[model samples]
Target: MSTLQNFDRRRITGPDKSLPPVYDSSPSAADPLASPEPAERAHRSPSSVRPIFLQTGLIPSASGSTYLEQSSQKLVCAVYGPRQQPKAAGAGYSDRGTLTVSLKFAPFSSSRRRAPNRDAEDRQLSLRVQAALEPAVRAETFPKAGVDVFLHVLESDGLDALVCGAVLAASTALADAGVELLGLVVGCSAAWVGGRTWLDPSEQEARGARGVMGLTCLPALGTVASVWQTGELGLEEVEQMADECRRACDELHHLAVKVLLESAKKRLGRS
Candidate 1:
Protein backbone atom coordinates (compact mmCIF):
# COMPACT_ATOMS: atom_id res chain seq x y z
CA MET A 1 0.00 0.00 0.00
CA SER A 2 2.86 2.44 0.79
CA THR A 3 4.51 1.71 -2.62
CA LEU A 4 1.29 2.55 -4.52
CA GLN A 5 1.67 6.28 -4.05
CA ASN A 6 4.24 8.74 -2.60
CA PHE A 7 3.64 12.09 -0.87
CA ASP A 8 5.03 15.12 -2.75
CA ARG A 9 6.97 17.91 -1.04
CA ARG A 10 7.83 21.30 -2.52
CA ARG A 11 11.55 22.07 -2.63
CA ILE A 12 12.78 25.61 -2.27
CA THR A 13 15.75 26.82 -4.35
CA GLY A 14 18.13 29.62 -3.44
CA PRO A 15 17.89 32.87 -5.46
CA ASP A 16 20.67 33.56 -7.97
CA LYS A 17 23.01 36.33 -6.95
CA SER A 18 25.59 38.12 -9.13
CA LEU A 19 29.17 38.36 -7.89
CA PRO A 20 30.57 41.76 -6.90
CA PRO A 21 32.92 43.44 -9.38
CA VAL A 22 36.59 43.19 -8.40
CA TYR A 23 38.92 46.19 -8.46
CA ASP A 24 42.68 46.51 -8.21
CA SER A 25 43.69 48.04 -4.87
CA SER A 26 47.45 48.26 -5.43
CA PRO A 27 49.34 51.35 -6.64
CA SER A 28 50.12 51.70 -10.35
CA ALA A 29 53.82 51.22 -9.65
CA ALA A 30 53.12 47.91 -7.96
CA ASP A 31 50.72 46.61 -10.60
CA PRO A 32 52.01 43.31 -12.00
CA LEU A 33 50.05 43.74 -15.23
CA ALA A 34 51.82 47.02 -16.14
CA SER A 35 54.02 46.77 -19.20
CA PRO A 36 57.75 46.57 -18.71
CA GLU A 37 59.96 49.54 -19.62
CA PRO A 38 61.89 49.60 -22.91
CA ALA A 39 65.15 49.42 -20.98
CA GLU A 40 63.92 46.35 -19.11
CA ARG A 41 62.97 44.60 -22.38
CA ALA A 42 66.38 45.44 -23.84
CA HIS A 43 68.14 44.01 -20.81
CA ARG A 44 66.06 40.82 -20.80
CA SER A 45 67.51 38.09 -23.00
CA PRO A 46 65.02 36.55 -25.40
CA SER A 47 67.10 33.42 -26.17
CA SER A 48 67.07 32.11 -22.63
CA VAL A 49 65.47 28.76 -22.00
CA ARG A 50 63.27 27.78 -19.12
CA PRO A 51 64.96 25.60 -16.51
CA ILE A 52 64.33 21.89 -17.08
CA PHE A 53 63.83 19.21 -14.43
CA LEU A 54 63.93 15.54 -15.46
CA GLN A 55 63.71 12.40 -13.38
CA THR A 56 63.18 8.69 -14.02
CA GLY A 57 61.80 5.58 -12.36
CA LEU A 58 58.96 7.40 -10.67
CA ILE A 59 56.49 4.71 -11.73
CA PRO A 60 57.69 1.37 -10.45
CA SER A 61 54.94 -0.56 -12.18
CA ALA A 62 55.90 0.74 -15.60
CA SER A 63 58.76 -0.82 -17.53
CA GLY A 64 60.25 2.68 -17.52
CA SER A 65 58.96 6.11 -16.68
CA THR A 66 60.07 9.74 -16.49
CA TYR A 67 58.85 13.09 -15.20
CA LEU A 68 59.84 16.32 -16.88
CA GLU A 69 59.11 19.93 -16.00
CA GLN A 70 59.83 23.32 -17.52
CA SER A 71 58.23 26.39 -16.05
CA SER A 72 54.51 25.59 -15.78
CA GLN A 73 54.66 22.68 -18.24
CA LYS A 74 54.79 19.30 -16.56
CA LEU A 75 54.41 15.82 -17.99
CA VAL A 76 54.98 12.17 -17.18
CA CYS A 77 55.77 9.35 -19.59
CA ALA A 78 55.66 5.60 -19.14
CA VAL A 79 57.11 2.94 -21.42
CA TYR A 80 55.78 -0.57 -21.55
CA GLY A 81 56.25 -3.65 -23.68
CA PRO A 82 58.92 -4.80 -26.08
CA ARG A 83 57.00 -7.82 -24.93
CA GLN A 84 54.83 -10.08 -27.09
CA GLN A 85 52.90 -8.33 -29.79
CA PRO A 86 49.14 -8.19 -29.69
CA LYS A 87 47.27 -10.94 -31.51
CA ALA A 88 44.85 -8.69 -33.35
CA ALA A 89 44.25 -9.83 -36.95
CA GLY A 90 45.20 -6.43 -38.33
CA ALA A 91 48.40 -6.38 -36.26
CA GLY A 92 50.65 -7.63 -38.98
CA TYR A 93 53.96 -9.08 -37.90
CA SER A 94 57.05 -6.98 -38.26
CA ASP A 95 60.65 -8.09 -38.21
CA ARG A 96 61.34 -5.02 -36.14
CA GLY A 97 59.20 -4.22 -33.14
CA THR A 98 56.59 -1.53 -33.53
CA LEU A 99 56.39 1.67 -31.55
CA THR A 100 52.91 2.79 -30.52
CA VAL A 101 52.73 6.21 -28.96
CA SER A 102 49.70 7.62 -27.16
CA LEU A 103 49.52 11.17 -25.88
CA LYS A 104 46.80 12.59 -23.64
CA PHE A 105 46.24 15.90 -21.93
CA ALA A 106 44.88 15.87 -18.43
CA PRO A 107 41.56 17.63 -17.93
CA PHE A 108 43.36 20.36 -15.97
CA SER A 109 46.44 20.50 -18.16
CA SER A 110 45.52 23.82 -19.75
CA SER A 111 43.83 27.06 -18.63
CA ARG A 112 40.61 25.64 -20.05
CA ARG A 113 39.27 22.19 -19.26
CA ARG A 114 40.03 19.44 -21.79
CA ALA A 115 37.97 16.41 -22.64
CA PRO A 116 39.22 12.89 -21.93
CA ASN A 117 38.89 11.83 -25.58
CA ARG A 118 41.80 12.34 -27.90
CA ASP A 119 41.34 15.30 -30.20
CA ALA A 120 42.90 16.00 -33.59
CA GLU A 121 45.72 17.97 -31.98
CA ASP A 122 46.44 15.13 -29.60
CA ARG A 123 46.58 12.63 -32.49
CA GLN A 124 48.94 14.83 -34.46
CA LEU A 125 51.23 15.25 -31.48
CA SER A 126 51.26 11.50 -30.97
CA LEU A 127 52.36 11.03 -34.57
CA ARG A 128 55.07 13.64 -34.15
CA VAL A 129 56.35 11.93 -31.03
CA GLN A 130 56.51 8.60 -32.77
CA ALA A 131 58.35 10.10 -35.70
CA ALA A 132 60.91 11.79 -33.46
CA LEU A 133 61.53 8.68 -31.41
CA GLU A 134 61.40 5.96 -34.03
CA PRO A 135 64.75 6.88 -35.51
CA ALA A 136 66.47 6.87 -32.13
CA VAL A 137 65.09 3.57 -30.93
CA ARG A 138 66.57 0.29 -32.14
CA ALA A 139 63.22 -1.31 -32.71
CA GLU A 140 64.63 -4.22 -34.72
CA THR A 141 66.42 -5.56 -31.68
CA PHE A 142 63.23 -7.16 -30.41
CA PRO A 143 61.57 -9.15 -33.15
CA LYS A 144 57.79 -9.59 -33.17
CA ALA A 145 57.38 -7.35 -30.17
CA GLY A 146 55.99 -3.90 -29.52
CA VAL A 147 56.81 -0.93 -27.34
CA ASP A 148 54.08 1.32 -26.01
CA VAL A 149 54.82 4.82 -24.87
CA PHE A 150 52.17 6.71 -22.93
CA LEU A 151 52.55 10.42 -22.30
CA HIS A 152 50.28 12.34 -19.96
CA VAL A 153 50.54 16.10 -19.88
CA LEU A 154 49.78 17.31 -16.39
CA GLU A 155 50.20 20.97 -17.29
CA SER A 156 50.73 22.89 -20.50
CA ASP A 157 52.02 26.42 -20.93
CA GLY A 158 52.74 26.21 -24.67
CA LEU A 159 51.59 23.61 -27.15
CA ASP A 160 54.81 23.62 -29.18
CA ALA A 161 56.95 23.45 -26.10
CA LEU A 162 54.75 20.76 -24.62
CA VAL A 163 55.23 18.56 -27.71
CA CYS A 164 58.95 19.12 -27.62
CA GLY A 165 59.05 18.22 -23.96
CA ALA A 166 57.03 15.08 -24.61
CA VAL A 167 59.49 13.98 -27.28
CA LEU A 168 62.40 14.30 -24.88
CA ALA A 169 60.52 12.68 -22.03
CA ALA A 170 59.32 9.73 -24.11
CA SER A 171 62.79 8.97 -25.42
CA THR A 172 64.24 9.17 -21.95
CA ALA A 173 61.57 6.84 -20.62
CA LEU A 174 62.28 4.32 -23.38
CA ALA A 175 65.95 4.38 -22.52
CA ASP A 176 65.16 4.00 -18.84
CA ALA A 177 63.11 0.93 -19.73
CA GLY A 178 66.36 -0.60 -20.99
CA VAL A 179 65.28 -0.41 -24.61
CA GLU A 180 68.08 -0.28 -27.15
CA LEU A 181 68.55 3.17 -28.60
CA LEU A 182 70.85 4.55 -31.32
CA GLY A 183 71.04 7.81 -29.38
CA LEU A 184 69.06 9.87 -26.91
CA VAL A 185 66.49 12.16 -28.50
CA VAL A 186 66.48 15.77 -27.42
CA GLY A 187 63.76 18.26 -28.38
CA CYS A 188 63.72 22.04 -28.47
CA SER A 189 61.30 24.73 -29.60
CA ALA A 190 61.69 28.27 -30.82
CA ALA A 191 59.39 31.18 -31.58
CA TRP A 192 60.07 33.68 -34.38
CA VAL A 193 58.95 37.12 -33.26
CA GLY A 194 59.82 40.55 -34.62
CA GLY A 195 62.38 38.98 -36.95
CA ARG A 196 64.14 37.36 -33.99
CA THR A 197 64.18 33.77 -32.82
CA TRP A 198 63.46 33.09 -29.17
CA LEU A 199 64.35 29.67 -27.84
CA ASP A 200 62.18 27.66 -25.46
CA PRO A 201 59.40 30.21 -25.63
CA SER A 202 56.76 30.53 -22.91
CA GLU A 203 53.05 30.25 -23.67
CA GLN A 204 52.54 34.01 -23.93
CA GLU A 205 55.53 34.52 -26.18
CA ALA A 206 54.50 31.61 -28.38
CA ARG A 207 51.02 33.07 -28.77
CA GLY A 208 52.40 36.47 -29.80
CA ALA A 209 55.04 35.10 -32.16
CA ARG A 210 54.74 35.07 -35.95
CA GLY A 211 55.82 31.44 -36.17
CA VAL A 212 56.91 28.48 -34.03
CA MET A 213 59.19 25.54 -34.75
CA GLY A 214 59.96 22.38 -32.83
CA LEU A 215 63.01 20.26 -33.53
CA THR A 216 64.07 16.87 -32.27
CA CYS A 217 67.55 15.48 -32.67
CA LEU A 218 69.68 12.44 -32.03
CA PRO A 219 72.57 14.04 -30.21
CA ALA A 220 75.03 11.20 -30.44
CA LEU A 221 74.37 10.79 -34.12
CA GLY A 222 74.43 14.52 -34.68
CA THR A 223 71.31 14.25 -36.84
CA VAL A 224 67.89 15.85 -36.79
CA ALA A 225 65.17 13.35 -36.10
CA SER A 226 62.09 15.45 -36.77
CA VAL A 227 61.10 19.04 -37.52
CA TRP A 228 57.67 20.59 -37.05
CA GLN A 229 56.64 24.13 -37.92
CA THR A 230 53.60 26.38 -37.92
CA GLY A 231 52.95 29.73 -39.61
CA GLU A 232 54.59 31.27 -42.66
CA LEU A 233 58.29 32.05 -42.83
CA GLY A 234 60.95 32.59 -45.47
CA LEU A 235 63.70 30.06 -46.21
CA GLU A 236 66.27 32.25 -44.44
CA GLU A 237 64.13 32.55 -41.36
CA VAL A 238 63.47 28.82 -41.36
CA GLU A 239 67.22 28.15 -41.53
CA GLN A 240 67.86 30.52 -38.66
CA MET A 241 65.16 28.95 -36.53
CA ALA A 242 66.43 25.48 -37.30
CA ASP A 243 69.97 26.44 -36.34
CA GLU A 244 68.76 27.94 -33.07
CA CYS A 245 66.63 24.89 -32.33
CA ARG A 246 69.58 22.56 -32.99
CA ARG A 247 71.79 24.48 -30.60
CA ALA A 248 69.10 24.33 -27.93
CA CYS A 249 68.70 20.59 -28.49
CA ASP A 250 72.42 20.09 -28.07
CA GLU A 251 72.29 21.87 -24.74
CA LEU A 252 69.34 19.79 -23.64
CA HIS A 253 71.18 16.64 -24.72
CA HIS A 254 73.94 17.32 -22.23
CA LEU A 255 71.48 17.81 -19.42
CA ALA A 256 69.56 14.68 -20.41
CA VAL A 257 72.74 12.63 -20.32
CA LYS A 258 73.52 13.86 -16.84
CA VAL A 259 70.04 12.97 -15.61
CA LEU A 260 70.27 9.48 -17.07
CA LEU A 261 73.68 8.94 -15.54
CA GLU A 262 72.41 9.99 -12.15
CA SER A 263 69.42 7.72 -12.47
CA ALA A 264 71.61 4.75 -13.39
CA LYS A 265 73.87 5.45 -10.42
CA LYS A 266 70.88 5.43 -8.10
CA ARG A 267 69.65 2.15 -9.54
CA LEU A 268 73.07 0.58 -9.19
CA GLY A 269 73.30 1.69 -5.60
CA ARG A 270 69.91 0.16 -4.84
CA SER A 271 70.87 -3.13 -6.46
Candidate 2:
Protein backbone atom coordinates (compact mmCIF):
# COMPACT_ATOMS: atom_id res chain seq x y z
CA MET A 1 0.00 0.00 0.00
CA SER A 2 1.08 3.62 -0.64
CA THR A 3 2.31 5.56 2.37
CA LEU A 4 -0.87 6.79 4.12
CA GLN A 5 0.99 9.65 5.89
CA ASN A 6 1.83 11.33 2.54
CA PHE A 7 -1.74 11.25 1.25
CA ASP A 8 -3.18 14.72 0.59
CA ARG A 9 -6.78 14.03 1.55
CA ARG A 10 -7.60 17.71 1.96
CA ARG A 11 -6.81 18.60 -1.64
CA ILE A 12 -9.56 18.69 -4.27
CA THR A 13 -9.19 15.87 -6.77
CA GLY A 14 -12.24 16.29 -9.04
CA PRO A 15 -12.19 18.55 -12.15
CA ASP A 16 -15.66 19.90 -11.22
CA LYS A 17 -14.59 21.07 -7.77
CA SER A 18 -15.50 24.66 -6.96
CA LEU A 19 -15.89 26.88 -3.92
CA PRO A 20 -18.43 29.65 -3.41
CA PRO A 21 -17.19 33.03 -2.20
CA VAL A 22 -18.40 34.18 1.19
CA TYR A 23 -20.35 37.37 1.68
CA ASP A 24 -21.62 39.40 4.61
CA SER A 25 -25.41 39.22 4.69
CA SER A 26 -26.01 41.31 7.80
CA PRO A 27 -28.29 44.38 7.65
CA SER A 28 -25.30 46.65 8.17
CA ALA A 29 -23.50 45.08 5.20
CA ALA A 30 -24.89 47.60 2.72
CA ASP A 31 -22.33 49.45 0.58
CA PRO A 32 -21.01 52.54 2.32
CA LEU A 33 -21.33 54.68 -0.82
CA ALA A 34 -24.98 53.75 -1.33
CA SER A 35 -27.10 56.85 -0.66
CA PRO A 36 -29.70 56.56 2.12
CA GLU A 37 -30.98 60.11 1.55
CA PRO A 38 -33.95 59.16 -0.58
CA ALA A 39 -35.48 56.87 2.03
CA GLU A 40 -34.42 58.70 5.23
CA ARG A 41 -35.56 62.17 4.16
CA ALA A 42 -39.23 61.34 4.60
CA HIS A 43 -38.78 60.30 8.23
CA ARG A 44 -39.99 63.18 10.40
CA SER A 45 -38.54 62.57 13.83
CA PRO A 46 -34.94 61.65 14.54
CA SER A 47 -33.99 58.06 15.27
CA SER A 48 -34.85 57.27 18.88
CA VAL A 49 -32.03 55.99 21.06
CA ARG A 50 -32.29 52.65 22.73
CA PRO A 51 -32.62 52.66 26.52
CA ILE A 52 -29.28 52.98 28.31
CA PHE A 53 -28.16 50.49 30.94
CA LEU A 54 -25.31 51.43 33.28
CA GLN A 55 -23.74 50.11 36.45
CA THR A 56 -20.76 51.11 38.62
CA GLY A 57 -18.29 49.24 40.82
CA LEU A 58 -18.30 46.24 38.54
CA ILE A 59 -14.52 45.72 38.67
CA PRO A 60 -13.23 45.36 42.23
CA SER A 61 -9.56 45.46 41.30
CA ALA A 62 -9.70 48.85 39.64
CA SER A 63 -9.86 52.13 41.53
CA GLY A 64 -13.17 52.74 39.76
CA SER A 65 -15.12 51.05 36.99
CA THR A 66 -18.39 51.29 35.10
CA TYR A 67 -20.27 49.21 32.53
CA LEU A 68 -22.57 50.80 29.98
CA GLU A 69 -24.72 49.37 27.22
CA GLN A 70 -27.21 50.64 24.64
CA SER A 71 -28.65 48.80 21.69
CA SER A 72 -25.91 46.47 20.37
CA GLN A 73 -22.97 48.41 21.80
CA LYS A 74 -21.44 47.47 25.14
CA LEU A 75 -18.51 49.10 26.95
CA VAL A 76 -16.58 48.77 30.19
CA CYS A 77 -14.24 51.39 31.59
CA ALA A 78 -11.77 51.25 34.45
CA VAL A 79 -10.12 54.28 36.05
CA TYR A 80 -6.70 53.93 37.60
CA GLY A 81 -3.81 56.25 38.56
CA PRO A 82 -3.99 59.72 40.10
CA ARG A 83 -0.80 58.06 41.30
CA GLN A 84 2.83 59.17 41.07
CA GLN A 85 4.09 60.08 37.64
CA PRO A 86 7.34 58.59 36.38
CA LYS A 87 9.99 61.19 35.65
CA ALA A 88 10.84 61.53 31.97
CA ALA A 89 13.68 63.17 30.05
CA GLY A 90 13.05 66.94 29.75
CA ALA A 91 9.77 66.43 31.57
CA GLY A 92 9.13 68.98 34.29
CA TYR A 93 6.50 69.09 36.97
CA SER A 94 3.50 71.10 35.94
CA ASP A 95 0.87 72.90 38.03
CA ARG A 96 -1.75 70.48 36.70
CA GLY A 97 -1.48 66.72 36.59
CA THR A 98 -1.69 64.90 33.26
CA LEU A 99 -4.65 62.83 32.10
CA THR A 100 -4.00 59.78 29.95
CA VAL A 101 -6.62 57.72 28.16
CA SER A 102 -6.37 54.35 26.43
CA LEU A 103 -9.32 53.22 24.33
CA LYS A 104 -9.28 49.64 23.04
CA PHE A 105 -11.65 47.54 20.97
CA ALA A 106 -11.80 43.89 21.84
CA PRO A 107 -10.65 41.45 19.18
CA PHE A 108 -14.16 40.11 18.86
CA SER A 109 -15.99 43.43 19.22
CA SER A 110 -16.61 43.91 15.49
CA SER A 111 -18.33 41.92 12.75
CA ARG A 112 -14.94 41.22 11.23
CA ARG A 113 -11.94 39.88 13.14
CA ARG A 114 -9.70 42.56 14.63
CA ALA A 115 -6.18 42.29 15.96
CA PRO A 116 -5.58 42.95 19.66
CA ASN A 117 -2.89 45.58 19.20
CA ARG A 118 -3.96 49.21 19.15
CA ASP A 119 -4.33 50.67 15.64
CA ALA A 120 -4.23 54.21 14.21
CA GLU A 121 -8.00 54.57 14.68
CA ASP A 122 -7.71 53.55 18.31
CA ARG A 123 -4.93 56.12 18.88
CA GLN A 124 -6.99 58.90 17.34
CA LEU A 125 -10.05 58.01 19.37
CA SER A 126 -7.95 57.91 22.55
CA LEU A 127 -6.76 61.46 21.91
CA ARG A 128 -10.35 62.64 21.38
CA VAL A 129 -11.50 60.89 24.54
CA GLN A 130 -8.76 62.64 26.56
CA ALA A 131 -9.67 66.01 25.10
CA ALA A 132 -13.38 65.56 25.81
CA LEU A 133 -12.73 64.62 29.45
CA GLU A 134 -9.84 66.96 30.38
CA PRO A 135 -12.06 70.03 30.72
CA ALA A 136 -14.35 68.30 33.18
CA VAL A 137 -11.66 66.73 35.41
CA ARG A 138 -10.03 68.72 38.21
CA ALA A 139 -6.52 67.82 37.05
CA GLU A 140 -4.85 70.68 38.92
CA THR A 141 -5.95 69.22 42.24
CA PHE A 142 -3.65 66.23 41.79
CA PRO A 143 -0.52 68.27 40.95
CA LYS A 144 2.23 65.85 39.87
CA ALA A 145 0.03 62.77 39.63
CA GLY A 146 -1.62 61.31 36.52
CA VAL A 147 -5.04 59.80 36.00
CA ASP A 148 -5.33 56.93 33.53
CA VAL A 149 -8.66 55.92 32.06
CA PHE A 150 -8.86 52.61 30.20
CA LEU A 151 -11.83 51.83 28.00
CA HIS A 152 -12.61 48.36 26.69
CA VAL A 153 -15.23 48.12 24.00
CA LEU A 154 -16.96 44.79 24.33
CA GLU A 155 -19.11 45.40 21.26
CA SER A 156 -19.45 48.20 18.71
CA ASP A 157 -22.31 49.05 16.40
CA GLY A 158 -21.14 52.42 15.11
CA LEU A 159 -17.83 54.31 15.29
CA ASP A 160 -19.26 57.69 16.28
CA ALA A 161 -21.49 56.17 18.92
CA LEU A 162 -18.66 53.95 20.14
CA VAL A 163 -16.40 56.91 20.84
CA CYS A 164 -19.24 58.82 22.47
CA GLY A 165 -20.09 55.88 24.70
CA ALA A 166 -16.42 55.54 25.72
CA VAL A 167 -16.32 59.13 26.88
CA LEU A 168 -19.42 58.73 29.03
CA ALA A 169 -18.23 55.46 30.53
CA ALA A 170 -14.76 56.82 31.31
CA SER A 171 -16.19 59.86 33.05
CA THR A 172 -18.51 57.71 35.12
CA ALA A 173 -15.60 55.47 36.13
CA LEU A 174 -13.56 58.53 37.12
CA ALA A 175 -16.35 59.75 39.36
CA ASP A 176 -16.80 56.32 40.89
CA ALA A 177 -13.04 56.30 41.64
CA GLY A 178 -13.53 59.53 43.63
CA VAL A 179 -11.76 61.74 41.14
CA GLU A 180 -12.88 65.35 41.57
CA LEU A 181 -14.43 66.99 38.57
CA LEU A 182 -16.08 70.24 37.55
CA GLY A 183 -18.90 68.15 36.11
CA LEU A 184 -19.61 64.82 34.48
CA VAL A 185 -19.04 64.52 30.70
CA VAL A 186 -21.79 63.19 28.48
CA GLY A 187 -21.37 62.30 24.81
CA CYS A 188 -23.74 61.90 21.87
CA SER A 189 -23.65 61.65 18.09
CA ALA A 190 -25.88 62.84 15.23
CA ALA A 191 -25.85 62.03 11.56
CA TRP A 192 -27.03 64.35 8.78
CA VAL A 193 -28.56 62.23 6.09
CA GLY A 194 -30.87 63.15 3.24
CA GLY A 195 -31.46 66.61 4.76
CA ARG A 196 -32.52 65.06 8.06
CA THR A 197 -30.73 64.75 11.36
CA TRP A 198 -30.70 61.32 12.94
CA LEU A 199 -29.82 60.92 16.63
CA ASP A 200 -27.65 57.97 17.58
CA PRO A 201 -27.39 56.60 14.09
CA SER A 202 -26.99 52.89 13.72
CA GLU A 203 -23.94 51.49 11.89
CA GLN A 204 -25.98 50.96 8.75
CA GLU A 205 -27.43 54.46 8.90
CA ALA A 206 -24.04 56.05 9.50
CA ARG A 207 -22.41 54.28 6.57
CA GLY A 208 -25.04 55.63 4.19
CA ALA A 209 -25.20 59.14 5.66
CA ARG A 210 -23.52 62.17 4.19
CA GLY A 211 -21.97 63.39 7.42
CA VAL A 212 -21.78 62.64 11.14
CA MET A 213 -21.18 64.82 14.22
CA GLY A 214 -20.04 63.90 17.71
CA LEU A 215 -20.44 66.18 20.72
CA THR A 216 -19.33 65.97 24.32
CA CYS A 217 -20.67 68.25 27.00
CA LEU A 218 -20.54 69.00 30.70
CA PRO A 219 -24.27 69.39 31.14
CA ALA A 220 -24.29 70.81 34.66
CA LEU A 221 -21.65 73.36 33.73
CA GLY A 222 -23.35 74.21 30.45
CA THR A 223 -20.13 73.74 28.51
CA VAL A 224 -19.22 72.00 25.28
CA ALA A 225 -15.99 70.15 25.89
CA SER A 226 -15.35 68.74 22.41
CA VAL A 227 -16.95 68.37 18.99
CA TRP A 228 -15.84 66.02 16.19
CA GLN A 229 -17.19 65.89 12.68
CA THR A 230 -16.63 63.62 9.72
CA GLY A 231 -17.48 64.10 5.99
CA GLU A 232 -18.58 67.49 4.64
CA LEU A 233 -21.19 70.02 5.59
CA GLY A 234 -21.73 73.80 5.62
CA LEU A 235 -21.22 75.83 8.82
CA GLU A 236 -24.97 76.31 9.30
CA GLU A 237 -25.66 72.61 8.88
CA VAL A 238 -22.84 71.76 11.29
CA GLU A 239 -24.21 74.09 13.93
CA GLN A 240 -27.70 72.65 13.58
CA MET A 241 -26.46 69.07 13.89
CA ALA A 242 -24.38 70.06 16.91
CA ASP A 243 -27.43 71.47 18.63
CA GLU A 244 -29.22 68.17 18.18
CA CYS A 245 -26.25 66.25 19.54
CA ARG A 246 -26.03 68.54 22.57
CA ARG A 247 -29.64 67.92 23.44
CA ALA A 248 -29.10 64.18 23.28
CA CYS A 249 -26.00 64.45 25.45
CA ASP A 250 -27.93 66.34 28.09
CA GLU A 251 -30.53 63.60 28.22
CA LEU A 252 -27.83 60.96 28.62
CA HIS A 253 -26.27 62.91 31.47
CA HIS A 254 -29.44 62.67 33.49
CA LEU A 255 -29.62 58.93 32.98
CA ALA A 256 -25.96 58.55 33.99
CA VAL A 257 -26.50 60.44 37.24
CA LYS A 258 -29.48 58.27 38.10
CA VAL A 259 -27.45 55.10 37.66
CA LEU A 260 -24.65 56.41 39.85
CA LEU A 261 -27.06 57.36 42.59
CA GLU A 262 -28.66 53.93 42.54
CA SER A 263 -25.25 52.25 42.73
CA ALA A 264 -24.32 54.39 45.73
CA LYS A 265 -27.51 53.45 47.51
CA LYS A 266 -26.83 49.76 46.92
CA ARG A 267 -23.31 50.08 48.27
CA LEU A 268 -24.58 51.84 51.36
CA GLY A 269 -27.15 49.14 52.00
CA ARG A 270 -24.48 46.44 51.79
CA SER A 271 -22.36 48.26 54.33
Candidate 1 positional error at 153, Å: 0.4
In model 2, how large is the Cα lDDT of residue 249? 82
lDDT of 1 by residue, 153-248 (tens): 999998888888999899889989999999999888888877788888766666667788888999789999998888877889989989888888
Clashing pairs in 1: none
lDDT of 1 at 11: 30
Off by over 4 Å in 2: 1-35, 41-47
> Of the candidates shown, which would achieve the greatest TM-score relative to the real structure?
2
- lDDT of predicted model 1: 0.84
Question: Over the stretch 47-69, how does candidate 2's per-residue lDDT look in tens digits?
Answer: 55657888899899999999999
Candidate 1, superposed: residue stretches over 4 Å from native: 1-44
Per-model CA lDDT versus the true structure: 0.84, 0.85
TM-score of each: 0.84, 0.85
The positional error of residue 228 in candidate 1, measured at the CA in angstroms, is 1.4
- Highest lDDT among the candidates is held by which one? 2
